[model samples]
Target chain A: MGLESIPVVTQSASDGLTGNAAAVLREIAARLESLAKEGQSGIIDLGAMPLSPADKAWLADKLGQGEVEINLELDGPSHVRETRYAGVWWLLHHNPQGAVTGEFIEITRIPELVLAHPADIISGSESLNFLIDDLC
Target chain B: MREQEGRLVASLAQQGISRRTFMKYCATLASMMALPPSAGIAMAEAMASSRRPSVIWLPFQECTGCTESITRSHSPTLEGLIFDAISLDYQETLMAAAGHQAEEALEKAIEDNKGKFVLIIDGSVATGLDGAYSCIAGRSNLELLKKVAPHAAAIVAMGSCAAYGGIPKANPNPTAAVSVSDIIKDKPIVNIPGCPPIPVVMTGVLAHFLTFGSLPELDKLGRPKAFYGETIHDRCYRRPFYDQGKFAKTFDDDGARNGWCLFELGCKGPITYNACATVKWNGGTSWPVESGHGCLGCSEPDFWDGGGFYKALSMPANPLKLAAGAAVAGAAAGVAISFANRAKKGAAKAAHETTTLADLEK
Candidate 1:
C-alpha cells in the first residue's frame, strides 16, 4: 500500500512570507550598507534587486532598482516630538505567497532617539534600539 | 486458591461496575494519557493484580477550588473512581481524621509509603513570612511539601496553583509561593495545571503511571502534551470565524451572539494552549469558549501574568511589517489583476482576427 505523510497544520499566507524571508532580507542589508557609505545628501533608491530571483527578474523587466532616498523632517507619532533620526533603513522583501502577498516593506535599522519624557533619564536606551531580541 | 484472587473478588464485589465497563474506562483513561489500547489492558491487569498505590493529597495556600472542582466532576465519576484507581490513603481536606488525628494520618502515610506511593500537591507552597500567611500543625506549607516530596514515587503537581504558583505568584506576590517543580528538583514532578485541572486529566495521568510504571511524556514545563498539544485556538469551534476574519467587535455584538471569533473581544485562545476546546469540561459538555467568555489560557505557565487578553501578541512579524507589507501587496495585486485583464483582452482579439480571416475565405 502507498503511504502518505499527513501535514499537521496548513500555514496561512502570512507565514509563507515569514518562511526564510531572512535570506532575501540579507541582500537588502548589503545594498543599504553600500548606500550609507556614500556620505552624501541624496536619495539612494534600491529599485533593482528585490532580494529574490523572481523579484529581481520583475525589477529588471520594469522599474530597474528604486527611487533615490530623501531626507526630510516629518511629523512623528503622538508619543515622539520633532526629532531627526537618520538612516531609518527600510527593507523590502518579495514573497510569492503572502497575506498581503508579494513585496512588503519594514523599517529595519534605527539608532536610539531618547524621548525627553517628564520622568527620569530612562537609563539604558534599550527601548529605542531597532534590533530584535535573542528570542528571534 | 490464592489470596490475590480473593482480594480481587472482594474489590469487584464491592462495586456495581462490570469488568467490561472497567476495561472501557481504563481504555478511555489510557487514550486520555495518550497511550495505546494495549496500555489500557495493561492498566486493567495492573488494577486487577497489584495492591492499591497509596496517595497523599496535600492542600496548601489555596481556595480549595481545585478540590471543589474535582469533587464536582461528573463524567465517569472520575474522582469517585480514583479510589479504585489509587489508595488515596490520606487527604487532609477529605479525610475522616482531623486535628492531631489528621496530622497523624499524613505522617503514617509518609512512613508507610516510604520510597513508594505518589504525592499529589494541590496548591502553591508559600514560603513568605515563614509561611505565616497560611499554616498547618504550626509548620508552613513549604515544610510539608519538603517533608512529603522526598518519599513520593512521583509527584503530581495539580492545578496552576501547585504547578506555576497560580494567582499568588502574580506581581507583588505577598505570599512568595513556589511551584512543586521548584523545590522538588530531585524527583520528576508531573504538572497537570489548570485553574483546577480537568478531573479526567488528573485521573488519566494516574492511569498512565499505573499502567506503564512511569509518567507519560511531558512538555518543557512538565505538562502532559496529550492534553496540551495545541492552542485552544487550534481546536476552538470559533477557529473557522478567525480564518474568515470574522471577529466579535464587542462583548454583545452579532459575532459574539453567533459564536464567531472572540479575538477582538480579548479572547486569549490564540495564545493559550490547552485541550479545553477538544476535551471540554463537565463530561465533555462545554468549555468556556463554547459557553460565552474567551479562554483565559488558564492552563499555561503564566496565564496570570500575561497582559490584557485583547492586546495583540507581540511576536516578531516574520521581520516583515504586516501593515505596510499589506499596502504594497495591494499595489501588486492591482498590477497583477490589470496584467491578467490585458492578457485576456489580447487573447480575445487574436481569436477574433482568426475567425474574421476564416469568414472572409468562406
Candidate 2:
C-alpha cells in the first residue's frame, strides 16, 4: 500500500474511550497523587492501557492544559503536552506513515523525551561555532 | 582543602549557558537524584553559589573503560563539563604529570585537600601475592588505597570492577580481586556498579554530595538507592508484553520485531537494577533492549558467572513419573472425599422432613 493512500484517522470526541479507560484514568490519577506526594516522577504507557479515542479525549479534557507544550520529531512527530493538573503529561507519538504508533500519559515534572539531549545539544553548539568561524 | 576556583554559576555563564539552561540542567539532575521537585530549585541555588568540589581519581587493575564511559563517550555533555570543572587534583590517565612529578603532585593535592576532597577510584584491588597483581609507581593498589582512604571525606567506587570485582574476579579468580568496600572500612563508600556506569549517575552522586554535603541513601550493596532501587524490568517499555505473556522466541521472529519481552532469551532485566531504561544511553538515545539485545546484567555482582547469556532464566518443569503419580493420587483423594460428602448430604436430605407452623412452635 502506498503511504499517501493510507487513511489518516485523527482521533476525535466521537472516537471515545474504550471500556477500560476508567481503570487507566484511575491509575493515572493514583500516579499523579504519588508524584505530588513523593516528589518523584514516572512514565505511564497509555499504549498498553488499551484506551479508545474517546477515552483519550476524556483524559485530555480531564487533565485540561498547562503551560508546557513540546513537539518532538524523531521516528515521527510526537506531541508532548502538559495538563493543567501539575506534572501530568499527555504524549502522542505518530509513525512516519502518520499513524498513531504509541501513546503515553507520563507523570513527571519533566518528561524525558522533552529534555534537550546532551549529545545533540553539544553537536549543535559545535556546528554553530564552526559556522561562525566560516563566516568570519 | 583545595582552594575554590570560581562559583559554578559564573563558570556556566562564561560557557554561554544561560540561567534558564542551567536551571533546566539542575532540574534534570534533581529528578535523576530522586530529590523532591522543589529541590530542583534548591539545587540550582546551591550550585550557583557553591564552588566546584575537589576530586582525585585513582585507576587500578582497569581497562580504562569506566573513564571512557564518563569522559570520552559522553563528551561535551553538561555532566562531562561538570566533571571537568571539578578540582581534579590527580588522574593518571588525564594528568600531564608522571613519574616522580606525578607522585609529588598526588601527595601535595592529598595534603592540601585532606578530609575535604572526594576520592574516586576505578578498577579492583588485587590482594593475591601481596597485591602485586596491580601496581602504580612501585606501590600496590591496596597499599595506595589504604594510605589515601584515611584522609579523604568520601570515596566513590566507579565501575563494577571497583564496586564488586568485575570480569577479573570471575571464575577461579586468580588475582584475588576485591572491591573498594573490601578494604576501606572507616569511610563512607558509594559503589556506582556497572561494567561502566551511566555518566549522569556519576555526576548525580557528585551533585548530591555537593548539594547536601553528605552521601545519598544507599542500597544493601552500598549503591545509591535512587538509581538501583528498582529492577530494569519494572521500568522497561516492553513490560506490558511480559505481563501479557508475549515473548520474542527468536531475534528475528515476528514477536521480536514487534518489540515483545525478551524474558525467554535470557534477559536479566528482571533481576538487574540501573537507570538504562529511563535515563538511557548516549544522551537518552537508546539502550541495549531497545536495540534488540537482552540485558547482560553487567551491573549485578558475579554477572559474568550468572550462567549463559543466551540461556533462559528458567524453563517450565517437565512432568516426571513422581509428579504424574502425585497428580493421580491427589485426584483420587479429591474424588473419594467428594463422594463421601455427597453420600452424607444425600442421606441427610432424604431423612429430613419439611416443618409446618405447628412443628416450628414445638
Candidate 3:
C-alpha cells in the first residue's frame, strides 16, 4: 500500500495591510539611512512587537531577499540573511528543538553575532600551536 | 540546589553553555523587557560576573500551578538558564528535602542569606480562624510569612493567589485569604499575577534583579511595567477585527470560525494588563486568546469575582429582558454602553490608581 502525502497549509497574504508593518518598514528605512551616514547599526526585535502573520508576510514580501544567506550553529541554529537592501539583515534564532526564540531585523554591514570572538580566536590559535608541538 | 561559589560565567561554562549563547539569552531577555539593545551587553556582563543570588520559594495556600509552570520551562531554555543561575536554596516543591529536613533547609537558607535572598511566595495567606486554615510544619502561613519576610531582601508574589488573594479570596472568601503585600508591608514586593503566571516573567524578574541589584520598575499593583504596561487588548491580534466591529457571538459561530474578536464572548482583554498576547506562554507557543478562548482576566485583582465568565463585560450580571422587537435596540444599547466603558477604561488607564482591597470588592 502507498502512503498518503500530507497536505501543507499556508497563510494567504492579507488583502489589506494590518498592524504596524508600515511603521516598521519606515523605521527600517530610517535605520538604513543612519547606518550609511554614521556607521551606527540598528536592530528591531520582531518578537517583541504585536505583529500578525499577515504583517510578517507583508514585511518579507516588501523587503525582498538578497544574495547573502548565512547559518550558524551556536546554542541552537540561527539564520541570518541580507535583505534586498544591502545593509539590512534578517535574523532568526531558534532553540535545539527548532522553535524560534528570537526574530530580528538588523541594519548593519554584518551582524555582531556573526563575528568570531577574540577569546575564541585566541583559544583556536593556542590549540593549533599545541597540535603543532605534538607533531614535532 | 546551592549555586557554585564562583563567577556565573565560569559556572555556566562548566555546564557547557558558551559565552555567546549566554549573551544571546541576555539580548533576548532585554528585547522582551523593551530595554535598549545595548542594555543586553551590560546585563550579560553584570550577570556573568555577579554571584548567583539565593532564592527561597515559599508555598502557602496554592495548588502548585505556578511552580509547575516554571519547571515546565524547556531544558537549557533562556528562562531555564536564568533559573539555573540562581541559588534555589529552598523550594518545597522542587527541593529534595521533606518534613524536618525541609524545615531545616528553609531555616538554614534564611540564616545564611538573611536580608539578602529573594523570597518567592506562590500562594495566598489564609487569615481566618487565626490562620488555622493553612499550616506548615506546625506553623500558620501567616506566622511563617511574618517570620521570613523581614529577613529577605525582596519578596516576589509569584501568582494571582499571592498577589491578589486569587480564587481563595473570591466571594465568601471562607479562609479570608490575603495577598503577600497585604500581610508584609515593610518589604518591597513585586507581584507577577496570573492564574499561573507566564514562566519567563518569573525569570525576567530574577534577571532584572541580578543585573541591576534591584527590582524592575513596577506598576501601581507592584507588577513590572515591562510586562504589564499595556492591556492585552492593546496587543491582541484580533484587535483589528474588534475595530471592524466583527465579533464572535457564540463559541462555534461562523465569526469565531473566521477568527473574529472575542469581545462579545466575554473577553476581559480590554482591562486585563498582561504580556500573554506579546511574550506569549509555554516557550513562545500559543496563549489563551490565540487558542480561540477569551481571556479570563486572571491577572487582574478580583478576577474570580468579576461577574460570570460568559457574560460580556458590557452586560450587567443579570442581563436586561428585552422584547423580540427590541433586540436590535438592545444591541445598539450594548454598543453604546461598550463605547462609554471604553472611554472610562481610557481614563482609568490614564490615572492608573493602586488597586486596594476595597477596590477588589467593587
Interface root-mean-square deviation (Å) of every model:
28.6, 11.7, 5.8
Docking class of 2: incorrect
Q: Weakest 10 consecutive residues, lDDT, candidate 2 chain B?
A: B318-327
**lDDT scores of the candidates, listed in order:** 0.61, 0.75, 0.82
lDDT of 3 at B206: 92
Candidate 3 scores an iRMS of 5.8
Q: What is candidate 2's CA lDDT for residue A54?
A: 77
Model 2's chain A TM-score stands at 0.73
For candidate 3, list the clashing residue pairs, or say none: none
lDDT of 1 by residue, B1-362 (tens): 23443244245546654443454456445555555434555776676556678898988877888887788875333246666657877787788888999888888888988989898888888888877777888988888778888899999988998999998886557888888888889998889889988887787787677667888888888988878777889877678778998777766667666667777666778767677876677665668877768887788776765644443343221122223221123434434534654665678687774333212111
Looking at the true structure's interface, with contacts defined as alpha carbon pairs within 8 Å between chains A and B, what fraction does model 3 recover? Answer: 0.24
Mind giving the per-residue lDDT tens digits that candidate 2 earns over B227-253?
898889988878878888889998877
* Tens digits of lDDT, candidate 3, B170-235: 756899999999999999999999999988788889989988999999999999999999999988
- Model 2, position B183, has a per-residue lDDT of 91
**Local error of candidate 3 at residue B177 (angstroms):** 0.7
Steric clash count of candidate 3: 0
- Lowest lDDT sum, 10 consecutive residues, model 3 chain B, at B318-327
